[model samples]
Target: MDTLTCHPCPLDAAELARAGRDDPATGALGEELAARHLVADGCDLVARNWRLYAGELRGELDLIGVDTAEGCVVVCEVKARRDASRFGGALSAVPPRKAAKIRALTAAFLREARLPYPRVRLDVIAVDLGRDPVLHHVLAAL
Candidate 1:
């Protein structure tokens, strides 16, 4: 596994915390952190921000990697927040609807990329960039 970081993040941690949810810098840093964390946990990265277009629908997968230990493909969704406590934390953001979409995206990815694996798992990484940066990882979340 290789280390990944937000190389082009224009905003510092403090600035990122102050920015809105759609701020690209904050999202990038969050994804980078999640990627590095997954790598440390023994995932071989496949792609980041992988977008797929099938017919009229388009879906973007935040992180797609292989969990070497499990011998399976791992699909990760990353959610970041400055104050997680305010909105029931980041995990709550991924509701059933989002999970369903992720499942659809996984099928599309496997078909389009012709990727094969013994199993496929859905995971979630929640990053809180408040007083201290905290990461919450949920394995096989969906």
Candidate 2:
């Protein structure tokens, strides 16, 4: 497995540890770590922080990964917390502003990347940073 260190994060790990319930900093490193995890699981990563299209209607997809599974492009939004208690509040953490952007961004990514796929899935990998980093992946969003 290949591991890449994300140095000089705008917010330090210590800062993420004490992030508020709905704070964006909650286990922020999990995105990079989770991206690695997905790659290790055999997903072909096409883009990281894919900012496709523009203007009042644009999107910023976090990760765009591909695999043979259903010929799908997986759009992953990662959320991580310190422990199990942080679970219930974790999924609620991805603010509408960010989520909306991601939703639009993924669309632009697909449109611009010209990814030919019969199936596209949006997923959220929520991790509770407990003993082993709990991951709750949501297949679809409402």
Candidate 3:
């Protein structure tokens, strides 16, 4: 079994945000927090930022984890915003169209990797970058 471990360089969200001038720092921080949250929930990290492209179609899964307790591959979509009021939080970001793409991407990932199609489920990790970061996880979200 191939797995990836996260070794996050010690940095606070503000520092990270400053470093990521082009993109919001909360994105990286949120993924890191989500990964840790998954581990705490008894899931093993399979991959992070796993990307695949076929022809003009390209997709990226923020975090892929195996929930050993549930015996399912957890394909997580991460959404981060500076505040919940910005766009109705992370969950709102994943519209029907995005969810459909994630579903298709999950299948493609399994086929391209030549891995058995385990019972797969989609999850969403919503990160609210307030004064203190808060994460809201919705399992089988889509």
Candidate 4:
């Protein structure tokens, strides 16, 4: 498994704490943090919050990046939590159904974008917004 250690962002902890779980800003901040971490890890981000609709299936992909070394397209699902312990942490937040949906969305993206990558990967980036912010990247998560 490939992983990267990320430091806290400039966003104030107080603001995030007050935002709570339903706040869109909190999730947006998590996506931003995940994107930065991916870039730092040598992945080139190609998309963020990409929404797709095919027939009756519709969903959004949080982040899409290319592993520079392996030339693999990576579809990332980002989960953010105020506390790591609550709700099984951000890492385990993605259930099997969600993973399956992500895979379908990835297929749609690949077909629509006509990306020539030899392989594709599913990843999850968990953002813990406790006293000390932590970012965990799980490669090939699904």
The estimated TM-scores of all candidates read: 0.80, 0.66, 0.79, 0.84
Better of 2 and 3 by lDDT: 3
Query: Quick one: how many clashes does candidate 3 have?
Result: 0
Task: Please say which candidate is ahead in TM-score: 2 or 4.
Answer: 4
Model 1 CA lDDT for position 40:
83
* Candidate 3 residue lDDT tens string, 1-142: 3232322234475655653453456677778778888888898888999898666668899998887777788899988766677558665898989988898888887776664545887888877665555677777733
Error of 2 at 85 (Å): 2.2
Tens digits of per-residue lDDT for model 4 on 78-125? Answer: 988876766577777888899999998998989888877889989888
User: Which pairs clash inside model 3?
Assistant: none
Q: What local lDDT does model 4 show for residue 137?
A: 78
Count of residue pairs whose backbone atoms collide, per candidate: 0, 1, 0, 0
Point to the candidate with the largest lDDT: 4
Best by TM-score: 4
Model 3 regions lying over 4 Å from their true place: 1-22
lDDT, candidate 2, 70-91, per-residue tens:
5788888877676656456346
TM-score of 1: 0.80
